[model samples]
Each structure stands twice: as structure tokens, then as C-alpha cells.
Target chain A: MNRTITVRPGLRDIPQGRLGMWLLIAGELVIFGAAVVSYLLMRIRYPEWGEQAQYTSTALGALNTFVLLTSSFFVVKAHKASLAKDSKNVVRFLSLTLLCGLIFLIVKGIEYSTEISHGFTLRSPGLVDSGQGVASLFWMYYYLMTGLHGLHVLAGMIAIFVVMLQVRKGKYFHRVELAGMYWHMVDLIWIFLFPLLYILK
Target chain B: MNIAHHEMSFWRRYIFSTDHKVIGFQYLITGLIMAAIGGYLAYVFRYNLAFPAESIPLFGSLGPKEYNAFITSHGAIMIFWVAMPLLLAALGNLLIPTMIGTDDMAFPTLNMLSYWFFFLSAIVLLLSFFVPSGPFDGGWTLYPPLSADAYINTEPDIWKSFMTGGTLIILALALEFVSMLMGGINFLVTTINKRAKGMTLLKMPIVVWFINFAVIDFMFSVGPIIAGAFMLLLDRVAGTGFFDAYRGGDPVLFQHMFWFFGHPEVYVLLFPSLGVIAEVISTFSRKALFGYKFIIKASLIAIVLSVVVWAHHQFIAGIDPRMATFFSIGTILISIPFAGIMLSYIATLWGGNIQLKVPMMWALGFIAIFLVGGLTGLYLGSDTFDIYVHDTSFVVAHFHYTLFPITFFGFFAAFYYWFPKFTGRMYNTVLAKIHFWFTFIFFQGFAFPIFFLGLDGQHRRINDYSAFDSLMSSWHISFRQFATISAIILILSQFIFLFNLLKSLRSGKKSEENPWKANTLEWQTTSPPPHGNFVKYPQVYRDPYDYGNPDMKEDYLPQNKVI
Candidate 1:
């Protein structure tokens, strides 16, 4: 089959893929923003929530934030490499990004287990039994915000892995930038989540 | 470049097709089916309302639980499954590409995926009815504490949480939102990236403009609800008191989040319907849309105001009086822009060779009926007045008047106007006219009397109004019975439309390409445009509604015509 590649410029200078990704990022930001806003409202409403916030290990959160920020940097490197037609560096940088995402998840897993084992679970059955159920609301927001951000990290990893595979074959190099943008969004959300959940108190 | 059109398997071409038109039809057909189900739910509830305990034909005796579930499902199905899919998904998919003179959506596969996700959501909604808890009786708004706490205690098993009707309904809604978000992204990208060479932003048809605006609004507004729904879900299943007041959650927060999206969602549905009305009115009236740029500006103002006016819905939900006043003012002020748009439509119809075509009839009907809907909204918008009639049948009547005209009236207008383009055939006009009259008359018969019932202080969502002595007056009973009968006829009259559709598809007159002689690019192409929409890609030269130009020999000019 023969087809003509119509060279009509898009209405704007931005590539369609990038524009679409930007719109998706904007949507994702609002979802996270609303959740964060809800958390803030409740936090302000109940000052005692800060007492429960003392249980969160800020060290683990800082470590995970560093992991995510590094992953975002790796993704940017991969995007730059793709633009330079350096397929090998693109694949290498993307692997590093994926590894960072995995580390972030693993750290998140450890945090969850530690919290849960200490009876700071989502339902906070132990706290509820002690008539401290209201304090458990802090844990609920923590888990929700972090859990949602973790899922985005996982999604970003899968996306990067797919783009990495294609980059190795030197196919669809432009997708590297799209995947990078999404990864940055994942990192950006974590940046917001880290402070909102762990650092605020 | 020319590529050979390869023959595709029926499954590939029709079922899982990536073509925007085929996907549009998928959404349209699915939406129509959901509308039927929603209408059936309405029938059962209306019957229950009118005849109280009487067992109706083909349906069993109605319990209070069943009545609540039916009303909830009817509202959910009508708004989410019927209106959103029909107006936003179907129309956007069908018209955005064709109107902009593009071959297909920017991302065809993503478009297909959006439809399938919507299909999945519809399935989940249907499945909710079969769930043991009986399909979420807490109202479409799903106010928490009631919605959150009811079913969690009944089922202790963690997996059983997924099967409860409330959770399922929430899941369905979340899935539906995801589907629309994907579809919205595709629409925004396609309109911005894929317009034909000369199709500037303002040069596109009003419907395309409205659709993109609606999609943008949906994208911005839907996020809060997605977050809210997730929290509500956790409240139900995980025992995380995000909305459970006893567990330190604020139920009122959920209300705020829901209405924040909910109010904008009203305009999200209305904008597309308004766009359809604009096209139908202009085409039949043989005029350029009056105050085209002004209408766009007014709609933009309305969209901005819609976001701020959501608190009005929660005026009686224990909101501060000062905030209520602010919201009430915002709500009332928002109507001015809409009124401007309405006046523009009316002015377009003035002193033109108005052809009262079937689509034009629906457009005129929409303006007349929706005016009542809009004007009545002002009364409800006032905090003082709403305090008296909050959640009464009056609010119900007002919204029905608004939504029915926007969803069904606007739908029929676009459906009839584009029937020739969709099927390459002419529907039997006499049959369509009869269908319209039956629908119009019975619709007014059904909704108009309910306004009086509401004024007489009949509250909505009551299983048995007879138990309340004040509500059982002769006036109330008569109007209730009249509305029920009219509703029954109104639903049955839709059969005429379905029959006309089927009959026209089978043996209607083969249509010329531009049956309506409209100036849009869609009509410039073949009747039921072939693969890629156009034989030769169109170069749009003028504004979409280039009608009634006295200098033009034909009295109208197609957008592609260079003359």
C-alpha cells in the first residue's frame, strides 16, 4: 500500500504526542491536586492529626523521593539521547530510570509493611479499638496519597520499559520523550505527595 | 498518495473498528440502548409513584428499596450512560473529524479504546442491578455516610465488597469517567492538531467548537470527582473514614467535591447540545449563526461561571448563608450568557427562508422548552426560594425540562439533520413529524404538571405519597396520574422514532450528498462518506455557516467552495 505523508503543520508548534501527554499530565495533576487539597482541609480541621503524623518515617519518604527524582533525571537523559539518535544511551538511561522506579516501589513497600506491622494500617483496627479512630484518619490520607502516587510510579515504569524496548530496536524514538514526560509527572506527583504526607508535620 | 482500500473482516471493520464514524455509531447505539434502559427505569418508578402498591405490567410489585434504586439508576443512567455518551462521545467522534475536514481522529486506536472502555462501563452498570444489595439506593449524587456505611456492614468478606451495588455503581462511574477522559483527550488533540489546511479555529463549525470546549471543561472538572469517588470507595471498602463522619471523616467534603464536578458536568452536556442546536437552527433558517463570536464569548463566560456556581446545589446542605448568597448570585449571573446564546439562535431564525425541517422543529422545540427549564432555574438558584422547594418535585421538573431538551431534543435534532449523512437515506418526514408532536406534547404533559405538584409541596423520591395527608389532595393525585400517563405515552412515542430509524435504513430514498444543502464540510462529502471521509480532502475556504449570502448565486456557499 502506498500512502502520502501529509506534511500539514499542526495548529500549534508542539508535536501531537507531546501535546496529548501535556493534557494528560494536566488532568493527572488536578486529580492529585484535589486529593491533596482534601487532605489539607482535613489536616487543618483536625490539628491532632499531627500527633499521628509523628509515626511516619520521614527518612524512608526522603529516600523514596530521592529515588523518584533520580528516575526523572534518567528519563530526561533518555529523552535527550533519543533526540541525538544515540539509541544505546537511550536504552541504558531508560533502564536506569526503570531501576529507580523499582527502588521507589520497594521502598514504598517497606514503608507500608513497617507502618502496617506497627498497627497504622488503613483501617487502623488497633487505633479504632483504643478509641483513637480519628487519629487513624491521618494514616488513611497518607496511604491514599502515597498509594496512588506509587501506582503512577509503577505505570511509569511499565511505560518506560516499553519505550526502552523500542529504543533498543531504534524504532519510534519520539516515544522516549512522551514516556519521559509521563515519568516526570510521576516524579512531580511524588514531589507533591512527599511533602503533603511526610514532611508537613 | 493513494492507498488501495483493502477489504477488512466484518469483525475488524464493524466490531473493533478504529474508524471514528464506526466508533461514533458504537457510542450512539450504546447510548440509545442505555437511554431505553433508563427510560424503562423511569416507567417503573413513575408507575410506582402514580399507582403506589399496584403491580404493573411486565414488572413486579415495587418496594421502597426498589423505588430508590430505580430513581438512582435512572438518574445515573440518563446522565452518565445516556447523555454523556450520546452528546459528548458520539457527537464528538462523528462530527469533530468530519467538520474539521480531517480523515479521522488523531489517535484512532485510542478512540477505539475509549469506546470499549465506555462499553465496559455500561456492562458494569448493568451488572450492578443484579448485585445482591440491589443497585445503590442512595441517590445518584451518592451522598456519603449513607452511601458509604450502608453495605459495608452487611458483607464482612473483603472480596464481597466488590459485589455490593454501591461499590459497583461507583466503579462503573469511575470507569465511565476514565473512558470520557480518554475520549476527551483524543477530541482535544484531534481538533487542535488535525484540522484541514484552511480550517482555522474560528472557521470550524459551532458544534466542533462546542465539543472541544466541553471536552476541555470535562477534563478540568472531572478530576475532583475522580478523587472524591476514590475516597468514597475507600470509605465503603477499606473502612477508611474519608466520608464516614463517625470515623472522623467529613461527609460535607464529599458533597463539595461531587458538586464541584457535578455543576460543570451540567454544562459539559449542555454545550454540545447547544452546538447541535446552533447547526440545526442556522442550516434550516438559511443564515449565518447570528453573533457567532459573541456567542462563543458568552459561552466561555458561562463555562467559567459554571465552575463557581456549584455551591448553589449544596445551599440547603448546611452551607454558610454568606457562601450561599455568593453562589446564588453566581448561579443567577451565569444564566445571562446562556440567554445571550438563546437570543443569538432566535435572531438567526429571524427574517430568513426558514425551512421547518424535522431537525429545525426539534431546534425550535428545544429553544421553547429549554427556556422554561432555564427560567425556572433562576427560582431554584435563589437561596431563599430554594430553601422552600429544595428536593421537591419542582427541582425534578426543572432539571427534566432542562436535560430532556438538551439530551433528547438536541439529540433528535442532530440525528435527523445528519441522518442523510449517516445512512445516505432520507427518513420518512411525515412519520418523523408525528413522532416529534407526540414526543413534544406528551413531554409537556408529563413535566409541566409536576411543577404544580411540586408547588403544592410534594417531595420527590417518596415511595408512597398517599401516606402523607397533605400530599394526597385531589389536585396532587390528578396531576400525578396525568403526568404518569403522559410519561407512559412519551416513552411509547419513542418507538415511532426507533421504527422510523429502522424503516429508513431499510427502504428510505437514496439521498444526494448534500441533502440539506448545508455548508459544512461533512455534507460536502459523499452521503455516508467512504473510508477516510472524503474522496478528495477538502480545503475549507469560508466559515461553516455561510448561508444567505445575497451575492452568492445559490443563496448559500459550502465551506470548501472558493467562489
Candidate 2:
């Protein structure tokens, strides 16, 4: 009978979920990497972009970077806690990770409103007639890159939340680490985004 | 591996099924239905193109606006809906698990989710046709500035509408990409970590390897386009300047992003079909695959090279001269590995006892047709020649030559080859052969004259060729007439296949477990294999293609056969 068989764990001796996450990371890098490369190329061609970059508040960018890094650290802690089978610590670190994500989005939201109040908007032909081509292009990249990064942050938080739910339900604790790995990727993209969009000049 | 078999209700068994086979059939049926829609759209436009003033039977006269919508949706539906679903999703899902000796996909829930995503996206796409702006008419490329702003479409109806067709198209396609992404992850994870005992990477059938290559290629290449689609959606809805030229955004960036995924996307579609051809050729030739290692290496080389050649499509779109030349060279280089694969298939056929069965005929037909397609692609790959053939029927003909054989011929081959094994019944051979000849002849007749019309300066995407400003020669009209006739016949011939498929399901000759006497792991299980595929875990002992082995008593040695 077909019931007389049992598949060995890891047919190739590699954890399938971890491998899937890594493959996803590579794909995400290519996506975000391509966008960043486009930004860098545009900046290189248009040198006035550096002057435009200086107008943005570097303090907020650096603060978000610190926030993301802290989240990554906590997610790592959650992964370690899960591996050590400490349910309480896993929940604790994951909650911290989720908190950091909220803070990052709130700060990003504040920055966006401030920039809009300063008349740096993404709405259409006004950007071209603003008489600063490089600045317009700079804000376009800033919003697109940061906006995409923020979406990633949101996705990461939801994933961390789900993993936390699973942990609380007392099942599938290994998913905590896999979800953390994805969270770290979100953090890593922001690390690049911080330098390129905010401080590169 | 032994998996516990559970008796499930009809909803769980079929509707929300996780069985790879059931999902494969779901994709097949859905793709066929969509293909009919795409094919009908072709007929509508072709009729209008041929006789611009005349009204058709059921549908009334189609205006230029309607024509544009038809052509655009036709391209999108045929590729995304029909071809991907039929060739990749269906065949890959159905065959990968059985051929690789697995119980089910690594992530069964994710597999189910992929199909549901596809279903939801298809529903959205269908609904877009009924929307106020009508479906997107920006061509399948969805090049921006025009695609970005509804006001730029020049259609009287769309101009007044804010909720444009392009947004709906983008949303539907984004969902489709997500579905494909999920399926890709499953394929990769399953193949990498779920192979049977003693079935190492190299020991896998060429089809499994091809699926692996195609899935990974999809995972790597599809990201940029996904990002681009999101950006384009934002540009349309939120007034972002990603591809809006008035806002200092470069439209060419969208083209780069689209084709970056676009070119590799064709290979992603082609590899699985080619994999099917490899299996069919080896099986019918009664020979081990010639240069199996070489084919794998060539596929990998082609996969790597496919990405760099994306800019060839952009040569006429105002790219740098140096970059154009580089892309032209890169495009030309892709044909080398393909030629190697082609030659290897021919080598497999050399000095072998060949069976001209329905599947074999289709496989051999794939080689003959794809050769023409590949050669003509070389013509279009040159930057100089592309200047003349750009947007012409010659380009259209060349594209049909490339894609039609894969989607039609390869799909039919897979259908016929695996029919008995999956359906547990044999189709009428005579009917199948008739279906093949009619399809092959009519499709060629349909595609070939379009090439001449293209070379004669007949442009594509125009609603009416009879307009005074048209650059078409007088002879081009007759060619169009001929093409129209051929297409009708080609479409009509499909009924024979449909009849054969439906008839074979219940009343045709019942199939044995190994009716074809092939040497694959799938043949070891019962036809229409049970819930848990194998009665005993199959331990692989030899290569899948062991045809005509001198030491073997029988002509073939199954992969799990014990000495």
C-alpha cells in the first residue's frame, strides 16, 4: 500500500522553507536593486540631484534607519528564541519587531506630509514646470523608492504578526525564523535606501 | 514517500483540490476556454481588417477603437491566459510530481492558492471588458505616456472616463504575476527538496529539469516587470511620474523594465514546451536522449543569455546605437544554444526505429516548425533588418512562427503524449492524425503569407487596410484573404481534437499502466494514479530513458525495475 512509505525530512538535506525564503530574497534584491540602480544612474547623469537631496531632512532618514536596524535585531532575537524553543521570548521579540515597523511607517508618514506642505508633490506637469528638473526627478525617486520600501515594511509586519499568532496557537514555531529572515531583507533594503535616498550626497 | 490518503468530500476533492493532477486539468480547461475567446477575438479583428466596412454575423461592425481593444486583449489573453496556463501551469503541475516521484507539491496549500489567484485574476480581466472604458488597448506591452494617462488613448469614449481600462488591465496582470510567483516557488521547492530516493539532480527527466530552469528563470526575471507594473499603476491612478514624460519621467524606462522580463518570459514559456519535445522525441525514437548533459548545459546558457538580449526589442525605440549593437549581438547569440538543442534532438532521431504516433508526429512537427520560427527570428534580431520589419506583418508572422508552435504544437504534443497515462484511455489515432495534419497545414498557410504581406510593407494593428493612407500593396489584400481563409480552417480543425479528447475520456480503449512502454517513474503507477500515486515507494535504479539498452531483455527498462 502507498501508506507504507514515509518521506525523509529534507530530501536534499536542506530545509525547504529556508531555501524558499532565500530564493525570494534573491528575487526581491533584483527588483529593489534594479530600481536603485535606475536611481543611481539618474543621479550620476544629473549632478544637481545632490543639491536636491540636501533639502530632505537627513535626521528622519537616519532615525528610520536606526528603527529598521533595531527591528532586524529583534527579529533575529525572535529567530534565536524560536530555535531555542522559548515561546515567551519569541513572542516578545516579534512584538518588538512589529512595534518598530509601526514607528517606521509613522515617521515616513510625517515626512511625506511635511514634504508635501513644502510643495514637493508627485502630481503631474507641475513637477516639470517647477524649474528644477533635477529636484523633481529626485523627489520622484525618493517617493518611489521609499514608498516601495514602506510597502515591504508593511508586508513584513503582517508576516511577523501571523508568525506571532502561530506561535501563540502553540504550533509551527519554526515559521518564526523564516518570517524573521524576510523581515531582515526588508531591513537590508532600507539600509540601502537610507544611504541612496537620504545621505548619499 | 508514503503519504496518508484521506477520503475527502467533493468540495475538497475537486473545487478546493490540492492534487497537482486536478489543478493541472483545471488550468487546461480554463486555458482552453480563454483560448477560444482569444481566437474569437482574432476572427473578429481579422474579418474587420479584411472587410472594414462589412458587418460580421453575430457581432456587428467593429470600429477602430473596438479593433484596437480586440488586438490588445487578444495578445494579453493568448499569452498570459492561454499559453502560460496551458503549457506551463497545467503540464508542469500535472507532470512534475509524478515524474519526480513525489506524493504532492512541497507546499500544497500554496499550490491551491496559486490557482485561486489565477482564477481571481482571470475573473477580473473578464470583468474589465465590461467596464466603462472598455479593456486596455495599449498593446500587450502597455508602453506608457499613452498607457499611463487615459487622455492619451485618443479614444472618444475613454477620454471622458477617469477609471480607465489600463488600470484594470494592470491590476489583473499584477494578480496573474502573483499567481505565477506562487507556482514558481512551489515548483522550485518541490523539485529541489522532494525528489525520490536515488533520483539525484542529474538523474531527473529532462522535463523536470526544464520546469526547474523555467521556474527559476521566472522567479529571477519576473521581479522587475512586477515592480514596473506597480509603478505604472501608480502613475495612472496616483499621478506619479514613473513613466510620464511631461513630468520629466522617461517612457523608455518602462520599455526597459517590461522587456527585461519580457524576453526571458518567452524562454520561460518555451523551455517547458521544449522539455516536452525532448521527452516525446526520445520515447518515439526508442533511443536514449542524445547529449542530455549538453541540452541541460545549453538550456542554462540560454537562460543566462535570455535576460541580456531584452534590449533588442528596444532597438527601434530610440536606444543608444552602441547598446543596440550589443543587444543585436546578444539576440543573435541566443540562437546558438537553441540550435544545439535542435541538433541534439535530430541526433536522437538518427539511426533509431522511429514511431510516427500522434505524439511523435507533433514532436517532429515542433522541430520542423520551430526551425522556421528560429531562422526568421534571426532575421528580426538584426538591428538593420528590424528597422524595415518593425511593426510590420513580417514581425507578426515571425512572432506567430515562434509562439504558435510552442503553444499549439507543443501543447498538443503534451496532450497526446500524456493522454493515455493521465486519462487512462487511448484516443482514436486516425482522428488525432487528421487533427494534426489539418492544424499543421492551415496554421502554416495562415502564418506564411502574413510574412510576405509584412515584407511588402503591410503594417500591423491597423483596423482597416483599405484606407487611402495605408502603405500596403494591392497583392497584400489577397494575402490577407488567404490568411483569413486559413485561420478559419485552422480554428475549425480544433473541433476534431476537442472531440477526440472528450470521446477518449470514457469510452476509448482503456490504458495499461505502462501502455507506451516508456522508462519513466510516472508509468510505474496506475493510469489516472490513485490518491496516493504509488502502491509501493519507487526506488530509482537507472536513467529515465533506457530505450534499446543492449543488456535489457525488453526494449525499455523502467526507472524502478529491479535486476
Best by lDDT: 1
Please report, in order, the local distance difference test score of every candidate based on alpha carbons. Answer: 0.91, 0.86
Top candidate, metric TM-score: 1
TM-score of chain B of 2: 0.97
Please write out the lDDT profile of model 2 over residues B1-563, one tens digit for every residue.
Answer: 23453567789989899988889888899999999999899888888877667897568989888899999999999999999999889988999889989888888888999999999988888877888879888799999888887235222233334356788788888899889888888888889898888888888999999988988888888888888887787677766667756445688988999999999989988999999999999998999999999999999999999988999888899999899999999999999999999999999999778989999999988889999999999888999999999999998999899899999899999999999888889999999999999999999999999988888788889887666445545677778888988988898899999899889886899988887789999999999787656777789988899899899788999998988
Report the alpha-carbon TM-score of model 2 versus the true structure.
0.95
lDDT (10s digit) by residue, model 1, range B1-563: 12544577788889999999999999999999999999999999899888986897779899999899999999999999999999999999999999999899988999999999999999998999898888999899999888887335533456787888889999999999999999999999999989888889999899999998899889999889999999988877776788867668888999999999999999999999999999999999898999999999999999889888899999999988899999999999998999899999999988788999999999999999999999999889999999988899999999999999999999999999998997899999999999999999999999999999888888988989867999998888889989999999999999999999999999999999998889999998888988799878899889988887879788789999987
Q: Give the runs in model 2 whose Cα sits over 4 Å from its true position.
A: A1-11, A124-129, B1-6, B150-162, B468-474
TM-score of each: 0.98, 0.95
Candidate 1: regions farther than 4 A off: A1-11, B1-6, B150-155
* Chain A only TM-scores, each candidate in turn: 0.93, 0.91
Clash pairs, model 2 backbone: A5-B2, B394-B454
